[model samples]
Target: MIPNLDVDLLKTFLAIADTGNFTRAAEEVHKTQSAVSMQMKRLEELVGRPLFTRDGRQSRFTADGERLIEYARRIVNLNDEAVAAFTKPELTGTLRFGTPDDYADRFLPEILARFSRTHPLVTVNVDCAMSPVLYERSRHGELDLALVTACSEIIADEIVRTENLVWVTSQRHSAHMLDTLPVALSHTGCEWRALAVGALERQGRKYRIAYSSPNSNAVNAAVLAGLAVGAIPEICLRPGMRLLSEKDGFPKLSQFRIGIVHRPGRRSSAAEALSRHISESISNMPRQLMAAE
Candidate 1:
């Protein structure tokens, strides 16, 4: 007989995948580290495949482990949806939600769609702007919840994900080969812009800001048009774009953090429900992006 996958074990597995460490995953799932290890052992026994391989102190997912992530997420989400449908009261109200344009493009569709299916009466008012602007709006209580990129100027209530920032150029263009690199970036005060310029300067590579915009789409447009190289999170990478590496004389850029911040004081049921959906949606994002690549 085929063994049934355990929802509790899958939740633990997802916590490990999301945190990238068993110790941290244990903390996340509110279990002892030893118990987490035992759970994984049982999981591997059930699947009859090794899920993780250790590299010194680090734990990396085996191929089968990576493949299981998508399935696990779907199962867990469906389980939650079923439970909420019967156990929780339906939420209704308008929710003021804010996020940067890039995140809105990449994540909001799935998040909002899933949310609406569960809480059809909750209307979400979305505001797209730079992260800094969103942070301020959330702080002022003008927004019920905001997803903001972490930077020196703002604090996030919870960091949902983190990924490497990469330098990219149009696949058909030689923009990265230019002596004075033409670059497209976000406007002043943007953390990505600062990181990009700082990386170039640290490498003693001369570059000029050929395009600057507050909107991510504008920067992406310049990049896709082959007008300039752009620095963006790996998840934001689009087709027809090639990454510039150290071999291309580009310095490695730091990882950026994505976080959720809430307005101070009591939040509406709609806001709380939406926030849970956002977190779960983002938790599965990196695995989906990796699978696509």
Candidate 2:
């Protein structure tokens, strides 16, 4: 008899794959780490193959685990789509929404797909830009709601998610060995840029900006090509990049607070519903998917 794989278990498997560790995966699924480990054991038994190997604290995926990810992503998306279509609530009207590029690329598609299924009559006008711009625009009533990357100084209406900041480099790169650490960073005004540079300066570490771009892809490319090292929201770090620790001479960085800011005052029923939907989707997102990759 062929054992039927549970969708929930598959979901958990993908979560582990995404975060590169069982503990982070457990947090995403609202399960204890021990429970996650137990689930993995059960899953491995079902597959009848070893699926993970220890890479320090990281759970490096075995060949089977890697293959399962492609299948898992498809299965989960299809399952979610079916569920959304059947359980949809009737909603209508247009919604003006804004999000930073990072969030937009990572989770918005699935969120919007579900929203479209649940509220077919509602039109969502989405603006994709930097967090600061989105937050400012929403504050001035230009957008009904916005997702912003909240720095310590920027107060937000509500925080929907959080991410640790970490240094990452290409697997083959050793830019940290240079006398002047080469950094791939965002533009001058980006909060992340300011934070990374500040941290380095405070530690008296000399670094040169080897590359700078507003587009995260360009920044990541710089790191991927072994030209430089960069800081990213740990949740968004993709596969192929190795995370560096303080032991590797990288300093600890502040956590990123993902905040939801909505226009002040009463909002339309559609807006309210969509806001709730967006918030839920974001808050429930697994750390791995937050990386646009």
Candidate 3:
């Protein structure tokens, strides 16, 4: 029997719709790009209409795709609600969680909102800081849970995702075109800063640290203001920020890893549950947030 256009298909459709890229949508569902494409083909077959069309590499919704979005969202929401409604215990307790501020601002609300729907009574006290600091605090028991942007060298069983680092500049600024490139980045100990500077030096590219901030907003602000080129994850590049490539004379940077850290040994059920939810929720980020036009 043909599966009844189930919740999984709806979720996949939504991910593709939201991300506009097959690879990204696959990331959301922890599937391979080929699998996502195959599923999309199956969905189109089931609906008996073309749902998407590609313009170059970017996927745009066809009329039929647009029509399905509303229904898909409603069905997915109802499906989730039904599942949560039956889950026992109402999952209550405080989980002391920590994440970097920039990531929190971009991704936390949706994560927490959905988590709350399933575990309505759970209280999540979130601390926003540098990812390294979050890990340190988690190690010392200052936080029950932490999501860290761990440098690739630091392996952890809890690693959830790995993303590439990209060189970027403000679309309004030609800073990267200069003889000595100006850079805006986090203060010392930032993995991006270290990897970026190292890449430049290895390539014999001259650069100066024109702006430094412990806060991500400040670094992005400086870059946005055309003060300097910036190094950040590709997922953080939105319009107004130009992603640099070999054509732009910038060398590639290393990957950044995201992982969960929790207190060693025994942990509260609430904290464990919250940590799992957070890991799953990490990919629920808004599309076009870092996507360049």
For each candidate, what is the lDDT? 0.90, 0.82, 0.81
Model 1, C-alpha of 127: deviation from truth (Å): 1.0
**Model 3: residue 249 alpha-carbon error in angstroms:** 0.6
Off by over 4 Å in 2: 1-89, 288-293
For lDDT, the strongest prediction is 1
Stretches of candidate 3 off by over 4 Å are 1-4, 8-45, 50-78, 152-157, 284-293
Candidate 1: lDDT over CA atoms? 0.90
The clash count of every prediction, one per candidate, is 0, 1, 1
- Would you estimate the TM-scores of all the predictions? 0.85, 0.69, 0.75
Residue-wise C-alpha lDDT for candidate 2, range 100-203, written one tens digit per residue: 67667676887788678767888999998787778788878899998788876567888888778889999887887889999999888778888899899999
RMSD of each: 3.4, 7.3, 6.8
Predicted candidate 3 versus true structure: per-residue lDDT over 1-293, tens digit per residue: 65478678879999988777888999999999999988888889888899989899787899999888877876786687568658756777788888887677656886788778777888899999887788778888899988778865433439877778999899988999999999998989888889999999999998899999888888888888898999987766766888889898999888888788887668887787677666655654334443657
Give the poorly placed runs of model 1, Cα more than 4 Å off. Answer: 1-4, 15-62, 287-293
Error of 3 at 38 (Å): 14
Give me candidate 3's TM-score against the actual structure. Answer: 0.75
